[model samples]
Target: MSLKVAVIGCGSIATHRHLPEYAANENVEITAVCDIVGERAEEAAAKYQAKAYTDYKTLLKEESIDAVSVCLPNYLHAPVSIDALNTGAHVLCEKPMATSIEEADKMIEAAERNGKKLMIGHNQRFVASHQKAKELIESGAIGKVYSFRTAFGHGGPEGWSADGKESWFFKKDEAFIGAMGDLGVHKADLARYLLQDEFVEVGAFVETSAKENTDVDDNATLILKSAKGTIGTLAASWAYTAKEDNSTIIYGEKATLRLEDDPTYSLVAQYANGETVKYELGAIQSNDEGGQTTTHVINHFIEAIQNNTVPLIDGIEGKKSLAIILGALESVKTKRIYSLEK
Candidate 1:
């Protein structure tokens, strides 16, 4: 039985990730696509052979969807996801799940009460390098992980806009926040997956340096303490000029593992026993970052729905990662460290 999907945002993520990946899978069918902009929805629907709608509520009401992917901006995440969950559709929502912990909690509550699977689009977990890192760490090559660091940076998505003009990426009203919400959550979620622990405390410094008109931080760095006592650093930016960078390094008592940097592979693991291992994780997608994230998350959600299993990045995991990022922002505003414990 093929699972029918309805997509609520027809932006870059929907085009690059959910639509294409779902179209490729015989078990999944994208039955409806929605966007506030009718043209955007039309383009996506034409490409994916889905029904286009300007209103997502109508799409949900008419589509008979087995699942939904909410790729809307931050402020809309909770409402859209809760609505979908209430409709009895499993949902995979794009990250920075909500602008605040309160909203994320509501989304989680909706999922639980509705008895539906709710996954977060923390695509970095599905990336080849990160996935391989998990495999290596689980193999016991790196024993008793201690500390870690990760970063995700790139020049602004200015060049990727639909009209080569400013869009919601720079609008605070639409985006809710900037680089931290845009990119930091990727590393936050990735770190959680690699460490297998939820972060409990965060101290951060954030600034808006690149885009003068934007009201949110464009560069931010976070220091985090996990529930298990592991310390980590997460940095995110939209101002890097050279190229994209996403990397993580983990140090364990037995060996060290590096992902996405110092090598194209997942790591350079040097054990205390004078042995070394290199694991290469090939390209996880066809050169589309958001697309890769969307695809991987979707597949996991679909499988979870089918098998009645928990997704790798469930709503609780999403809430935890979002709490870290939100705490970082809160720390910056209050000029003190914020509790992930909240």
Candidate 2:
């Protein structure tokens, strides 16, 4: 049986990732599209042959979709996902799952109470290179990863968001945090996945030195220590005016892994034995190209719902990733290390 799906928030993510991917899934049907901007909703709905809604609550009350994608701004991710879960629909919420820990907790509770699947849209985990890196680490090919550095940066949301800089992305209240939430959250989740460890402590320096007249931060640097004693630096910036750089380097006792860092190879491994292996897994997903290279995220969500299996990135995992970013934010505010224990 095909799954009936509704897409909430017909913005850039919806347009570029969610909607097109859903349309391509033979086991899924786009039942509705909701966005505050009526025209945008209508456009997406018309293309998908689904109803359009200006208010998400009305969509939840009226549509009988089997699943919903919460693609709204960061602030709306929690509430909309909770509402969808309450309405007997599995939810696939966009990342940074919630603005605060309390909100993240409520989202988890609501999904449990409703007995629905709740998956976060941290698509980086689905990347081919990243998956291969995780496999190599698990198989002990890297031999005890000791330290790493990962960064995600672009020329700011103006180059990507549907509404440019004037969009909700620049609004502190709407986005909650800037580069840290928008880009860094993905890396935080990626780190945990690759290392199979949770970050227990974070020391950060988050600043709004770029993107004039915006209250939200445009650049951030974080020092993260995993519970297993792994140390790493995560840098997120909206100041990559020349090019996008989403790269990671993992140094281990035996070898080092480079992901999305080399021009010819998407993944490269250099060992102490003077042997190097280069892997070409194609380019990482970017704004320059859409609709083709997404990380099988939509398909995974459908498989989890249809098979009645827990998604790889569930509520607990999502919350753990969010805690790291939130910890960094607190670290910046207090000018001290933030502990994730509490």
Candidate 3:
């Protein structure tokens, strides 16, 4: 049976990835789409051959929606996901599940109480290069992975959205944060996914240095300690002038894995026995692949639902990543090490 799917938020990601991918999948049907902007929802629904709604609650009440993709702003993620879970629909929420830990917990609680799957859109795990890195790490090529560094940043979203200033991404109340929420959480999430651990502590600093007159932070740097004793540095900024950059470097006892660097590869294994090899398998850049992050994301969720198992990026996983980012924000304010594990 085809899983009936409703997509909430018919913005860039929906138009480019979610609806299109669902439309291509024979196992799922995108039955509806919702957005606060009625025209945007209508346009998306028309293209995908689905119904349209301005209110997510209205879409939730519609019959036979087995699952939904909550692509709303960061602040609305928990409420919409919780409501969808309560409505007996599995939810695939976009990253940084919620602005606060408490909201994230409530979303998890709702999913548990309803016995529904709640997947987060930390899609980089499915990226080819990242998968390759995970394989190499698990195979011990990267040794113990004692430490790592990862970063993702861009020159802001002026080009993506038709109206840069009017985009909800700049609004603190709507988006919850700026570049950190927009890009940094993905790096943090990808780090956790690759390392197979949770960040326990974060000493961070964040400020709105680049985008003038914006309420949210446009630049952020974090020092994090993972549960596996891996201390890492991460930075996210919206001030980049040239191009988007997403890179990760791992320090293993034997070899080091570098992703998103030039030559587009992972798993450059170095051995103590005087052997150096480069695994030049390329990566799936998030902004590239036709701007298709949720394409791979929704496919994984469908596979999980079909197989009766867990998605690659689940809600609890989402909470873990978001906690690190939030901890960074807290650390910035307190100028102290924020403990997340406790």
Candidate 4:
């Protein structure tokens, strides 16, 4: 029997990533869709032939869902995920897992107690170029990565969010964070995945200079130190008016690897001896490019549920990535380097 699934939020992330991907996956059926805006929920439900719900609580109580994609706002991630897990459904929550680490821990605990899988939708780890970069790094192509810089920037969420400029992404209470949570968390997760290391400390300059009427930050730059003493910068910005910049550069002892830094190649490696190689792996998904047809996140979540296995980006991994952003926010508030060592 096909696993019955539901999408908790009918927002951009759900429309672009979860809904379409789930519809295409033959192993699952879209059972319901929920959104506060009745029209949005109705539209998505009609398109997918699923039930519509304005309240997630009602849907969870009624639907016999086997899995759910919690694509709600940052603040709702933890609670909705916990609720879904308790309802005997595996959950695939969007990025910036929770507004706070304490909330994230509770979500993880709920999943464990319910014996259900909880995965974070950090699609960067599944990108072809990023996966190839990890392979190269693991194969000793880039010897002893010393320093790196990764960035994720765009024109802003107004163009991407389903609600436009009035979106919850600009609200401090609803979103809890701005670019750092939206874009920066992805890079933080990517950096850890690529290096296979954990960040020990973080220092950040998170600000809201670009957008008006928003209590949250519009741009942020974080300096991070890994457990292995590797240092690097991770930048997230909504002020890049020209074009999106999702790129990473890893400086190593023998070579420097660049991922999504060039237009022609998805990944490039330059050796110290003047040899350079470029890989034309597919382009990284971008809002400008109409987003990706499949991010591989939904599929992976389904696979994990079907196989009764833990997802690669499980709740624990999600919490670790969230800690980086939370640490950066604390660093900004306290004007001191935030330590993740504890």
Identify the candidate with maximal lDDT. 4
Clashing pairs in 2: none
Q: Which residue pairs clash in candidate 4? A: none
Candidate 2 lDDT tens digits, 1-342? 999999999988999999999988999999999998999999999999999999988888887889999998899889889889988999999988999989999999999999999999999998888999999999999899899999999899998889996989999889999999999999999999999998889999988987987999899999999888999999999998888889999999999999999988999999989999999987788765654677688999999999999999999999999999999988988999998876
Give lDDT: candidate 4, residue 199.
100
Structural similarity to truth (TM-score) of each candidate: 0.93, 0.98, 0.94, 0.99
The total of clashing pairs for model 4 equals 0
Query: Candidate 1 regions off by >4 Å?
Result: 161-165, 284-295
Q: All models: lDDT?
A: 0.83, 0.92, 0.83, 0.94
RMSD of 2: 0.9
Better of 3 and 4 by lDDT: 4
In TM-score terms, candidate 3 sits at 0.94
Q: Candidate 1 on 197-233: residue-level lDDT in tens?
A: 7888899989989876777778999999988899979
Best by TM-score: 4
lDDT of 1 at 301: 80
Provide the global lDDT of candidate 4 against the true structure: 0.94
Model 3 alpha-carbon drift over 4 Å, by segment: 270-274, 292-295
Error of 1 at 257 (Å): 1.3
What does candidate 4's lDDT look like per residue over 1-342, in tens digits?
799999999999999889999999999999999999999999999999999999999999999999999998888999999999999999999998999989999999999999999999999999898999899999998899999999999999999999899999999889999999999999999999999999999999988999999999999999999999999999999999999999999999989999999998999999999999999988788889787546888888999998999898998999999999999988998999999999
Ranking by lDDT: 4, 2, 1, 3
- Residue 98 error for model 4, in Å? 0.4
